[model samples]
Every structure is written in structure tokens, then in C-alpha cells.
Target: MTSKPLISVIVAVYNGSKTLQRCIDSVSDQTYPDKELIIIDGGSTDGTVDLLIANNDKITYWQSEPDNGIYNAWNKALNHAKGDWIYFLGSDDYLWKRSVFEETSSHLFKAESENIRLVYGQVARVTKNDDICCIEGDSWDYTRRGIVADGICTFTHQGMFHHRSLFETYGKFDESFRIAGDYELLIRAFKEGGAALFINGLIVAGMQTGGVTANCTKLVKETARARRNNQLRVITIPWLISYAWAICYPSLKSLIGDKNSRYLVNSGKCFVAVLSYKKNAILEHNNN
Candidate 1:
């Protein structure tokens, strides 16, 4: 006679009216019944508040107020979460399917007894036109190496779920990291003693390509800083390679478009039979 664990979905947004409805609809239509949706708006003036009010019935709790940044908004939302598992859903992103929660519930149920702090799968990176760019995420074996040794983030937060105990133990997102705070928090947990489980073949969300994280230089710099702050060395070869790719990716995407740019990158890597810290799921498909 045990009840299903509750999942608190937190969305932090600003001026996100355009895609917010899609995001809200995706969450509201989920098949899972034991879930709550919480949203924090960064005092947007672009009609985002209106949208929030219209969808108030579906939201467990929502607020429209100025916040420092994404992490700040997320930290604020944490104060109101009352679930065993927490998920951060981007206002510009949506769950890949309505059944995502129902499908992942069994994994989350099992993770409880195993004490796994992170349960993640893959996310589809899409262009503004909604064309899939690539699938992002790797096995924990690959993720652990990137986080622990290379100080790289090999997974997207949109596809990851955090156990409540992780926050109770390591605390919430670091507001200092504007773009890489999510990565920083994960680093703290994994480096200090946290276990993660990766669900293969599960594509949890579709993440739009452009965002604050699209500023490659700032993102890479902040990622490096987070690693340094977490006691990881900053000069690893993988880190250097990531920095180089970050610098080039924007211009490359601009010239060839997002989908083509990713295809080219993966194609080049496949020819060399070499893999970096993060492996693209598309590469395997393209190779075949």
C-alpha cells in the first residue's frame, strides 16, 4: 500500500511566452498523476505573466518576480517543492512525449532503494525550426569520467532528475554560475560521492538549441571556473578541446545551420575512430 513518489517539475523562465505554452502543455498533459509543476518567472514584461495566469490551474505554484539569473530562479522554486524527486524543465523546452513521466517512474522507483542521486536519459537538441540536431547524454560511465576527470558536462539538465536527498546533502544550485550552475551542482554531488543511473534509449526532452548556454565562450569559461572551484584541475586536454570546439561551434552553426553543423562534427569524429568526453548518439546512427 505504498504511494507513487511525487515529482516536482520546476521551470525558470523570462520572456518565454512564445514557447512557454508548449512547455506548459507538455508537462500538464503528462500521463503521470503524482507530479507537481512549479514555475518561477524572472519578472518578464513580454506577456509571459499573462500566459502563466492563463495556465495557473495546471501549475502547482507559480510566481512572477525579478530574479538574478536562471540558477537564482531555480533556487527560489526549490523553496516550494514538495516532492521526492525534482526535475528542472526549461521554459523553452518540452518533454519529448506525454508518457515520459509514466515511462521513467519505474526507474525512479528503483533508484530510491539503490540510493542513486541522479537518474538521467537523453535529450534531443533541436533547432529553432524543431528539427533534431542531435541527441545529448551518455552512459554514466562516460558521464562520470567527464565530470570527475575532465570537468565537462556530458548530459543536459532537461533530461536529468535529481533525488531530494541530493539537495538535502549537497545543497541547491550555485547562483554564482550563471550558465554552468547546473553543471556545478552535479559536479559537487558526483565528486563528493553521488551515484547516477543512465536510462538507455530514453529520450526525455527536446531542448531548443539557442539559449543563454548558446554563448559558447561564456559557457566554457564558466564551466572551467566551476571545475576549478570544485577542486578539479582546469588544464586537461579534454577541457582544452571543449574550449576549442565552443569557440568554433557558433560560427560553424551560423555558416551551415545547427543540424548540418552537428552532422559535420560527428562525421569528422567518426572518420577518425576517435571519441571525446561526450559522444553523440547521432554519430552511431550516422555511422551505420
Candidate 2:
């Protein structure tokens, strides 16, 4: 691979008129010259098509059609991409800065020599209330921890830049999973010995509070199912408690008349569960 390989920024949208311009502009404003912006719109009717038409000069390849789900749309994007590295961006998300791709290129080139299939950086989660939370990408150790503990997701997809060969090697995202396909794909890649490099800068700013994964109950259940399907041991208690909290937290707050108290209780439970899992893992390692 070349030192500065072509990067494909793929975005799949469905009626994303409100935020599509922001996403498109972010990619257009990127300082990286050898990049292509490929957008696969799922037959949007909310003025998105007009906006796309107006910006046809900016987009390398774009098509609007009905698709089964986001994964299917992504698969379409992959088919049209001509770049060596692929970065998937959400319609609601944007690149952290104009220099994101420029800053990441050197690390990606080094990782390429080491045969790494993925390079990821940190993402700043922009909540609905405009609160920002930083989520870091995973190292091998962090990935191993996630395999053992079901409560954690090792990385967010928004900040990750994947080699095109990874899809050819491990297959595309499983279209059957409406919510947890990204998680499932990551687990499968790691299990198949696909190495990853974690870069040290912010790549994208993702909106945290919306989308299909926003339903905490569905997310927790799907995540557990993904873990089980990957043959990773699932810790039932933490997930069960999390599900219950998602469902009952509002009622509990109403009864107690204190939101902070409920938040603390939920946070404490999760903290304790993480500690317990870590303790058990350490014990098992020492015994072995």
C-alpha cells in the first residue's frame, strides 16, 4: 500500500435531509486530497435528493434506492468504493476536524506495514443535550476484556478506518442484525486475528442519543445475543439489571422524586459488576 492510500468515506442515509448537509460538508472539507465521498441514500424523499443533486460535484459516487436496512445500504456503498481504506460515517455524525484524515494517514501507513486491518481513534459523543463524552478506541487488551465482559463494547464504528481487505477476509456486516451488526462484525474480525491500531486523536463526533441503538432495552438484548452468538461467555446479571434499569428507572425516579439518586444507583450497579468481572478474570488467570 502507498504511504497515502485513497480513503473512501461511505455514508448510508435514509431521510437524513436535516443532517446530510453537515455530514457531506465535513467530508468535503477534509484536508486529505486522495479521498472519495460515496453516499448510499435509502431512497430519501425529505429534500435530501435535491441536496444530493446540488452537491453532485462534491460526491464521487452516489445512488438513491430502497434497501432492507443500513447494513444493506452500507454493503452497496462498499461495492461502489474505489479506495484502499474505508471509513463509514453516520448521517448525523461529522468529522472532528478538517485535518482528521491527514493526521491519521501516517499511523495508517505504519499499521499497513504491520498487516493491521483496522485503525481507529477516539470519538467525541455529542449527546442530544449537547453534552460531550469521549470514547477511546480499543487496544488488543481492551478487546480481550470485552470478550470476557459482556457489558462493554470495545470500540465505536464512527471513529474507525478499516482496510478494504478486511471485508474481503471476514465478510460484510451481517444484515440480519438490525442494531448489533457493527458489534457482531467487530467481534468476528477480532476472532479471526484481524489486528487493529488505535490512533491518538479525535476522528469523528457522533450523536449519541438517537438512532436505532438509542433504545437501551433493545441494545442490551441484542448485544447479549451477539456475545452469545460469538461463543463469548455472557454475564447474565449485569445485562439483566441494565435492562431492568432501562425499563424501570423512570418509575423508580417518580416514586423517589430524585433523578440523581436513581442515576447513582444505576451507575453503582454497573461499576460493581465491572469490578466483579475483572476480579473473577484475574482469579482465573492466576489459577491457570
Candidate 3:
């Protein structure tokens, strides 16, 4: 008898017909065979569904319909993933190397079966123009230190593999957050989910240099929101709300200038140290 693919790959697409072809091709080129690939479309009117249909046989299953939002789309995709391990690759991104699947699965099997919850690899940034910026030595080796710290993010929905139940433990992504939902979901994963490993190779993501995040103003605002999430459980909920309001108080001159910066500066220093060192930071993440 033959064995099945160890990972189930999901590609989430919505009006991504422009780049969906490259994304699908990357997954098909994966050296590891026997994996199932699922594409979930959120009712694209721009021929995205047609592109997915042209290669229908390669996809395990795909459908187009109205949905709540991106995170909700991801939750729906998770339901269709049936492999021993699951990886969610966005339609706008492609895998870096053909060996990515094999490399990620290598770590998955290396850990004790009971200890394997998820495996995340590094990511290469491909720009909006499709220019690739491969950054080596950025793996961060999530398993050893974990990936829940501030300023630390796990990329490559393409290469982040996990056991099916990892999602169950943390629950689904919070739909309330419009911009920081993925960050919130990953925070949930590393904080509450079980064991995980990080591979030291580049996986795949178009790290568009001029993307929304690159714009300094947007980055600053989102950084502040992420900072609030970082402090969510450490302080009382009411206090946290006050702290968040303080951080968001751009209307006041002291908020933007260094006049009232001492509290924030000191708080950020503590956030970095405490976030990186916790043995199982997830337990502390939701205490509030």
C-alpha cells in the first residue's frame, strides 16, 4: 500500500487572479508529493475563479462564495484541510523552493510525535513587481524561543505547517480586527498551542518593499495596535484599555512628541524582554 501526503496545502484567493497562477504553480512544483491542495475563493468577480477552474483537477477542492472576511475565509479553508499536517499559502504568495515542503516536514517528523504541533520556516520577500528579495539567516528558529514576541512574525502561510488541532486549541482568528487579525491569531497559536519547530530555510512570501506596511504612517499605527495586543493580558482589562487609549492618543501633542514618552518607552522595553523569554507565553497571553 502507498502512503498519503503528509501535509494538506491551502491557497486562499479573493480577486487574486492576477497572481493566482504563479501561486498555484509553486505548490504543484513542491518536491514532496501526495499532498492535497485546496483553494478557497471568496466570490471573485475578476476571473480568479476561472483561473482556479482552469486547473481544477490539480486542486483537491475549491469553491467561490461570499464570506465574512479574510480571517473568516481562512477558517473556512482550515475545515477542508485533511492532511496529517496543514499549511495555508495565500494566493498572492508562492513557495520559495521546491524542497520547502520536504524541509518543513523533516522537522515535523524529527520531534517526538506527541510534541509536534506546528512547523514554521523562513520567508523570502517577493515584491509587487515580482522582484525577489531573499533574506537568509532570518529564521528566528521559532520552536526554541517561540514566535509570539513583539516585532517577531511568522510568514509564509505557504510553509507554516501545523497539526490540525493547533487551530482548535487557540480557536479561530478573531474577525473583529481588520488589520491585525493575523498577528492576533499567531499570538494565540504560540501562546496556547502545543509544541512547534522552526526550519532555518526561506519558505515563500512576496515581501513587497512598497507594500502597505512599508508606508511609515501605516506601520506606525499598526505597530501601536500590536503593542496594545502585547500588553492585553499583563495589565487589568480596564487598565489595558486605558494604556491602549494612551498609546492611541495622537490627538494630544504629548502623545506624538517625547513629552509623555517615558511610560511608553519603558513599557516597550519590558514588553520585548518578557515576550521573548516566557517558557509557554501563550498561557499568559489570555489571562485577562
lDDT of 2 by residue, 142-185 (tens): 55445445455545688888899889988898888887788878
The whole-model lDDT of each prediction reads 0.85, 0.76, 0.59
Candidate scoring better on TM-score of 1 and 2: 1
- Candidate 2's TM-score reads 0.85
Ranking by lDDT: 1, 2, 3
TM-score of 3: 0.69
Candidate 3 off by > 4 Å? 1-5, 112-114, 134-156, 192-195, 202-288
**Top candidate by TM-score:** 1
Q: State the lDDT at 217 in candidate 3.
A: 37
Rank the models by TM-score, top first: 1, 2, 3
Q: After superposition, how far is residue 94 of candidate 3 from its true place, in Å?
A: 0.5
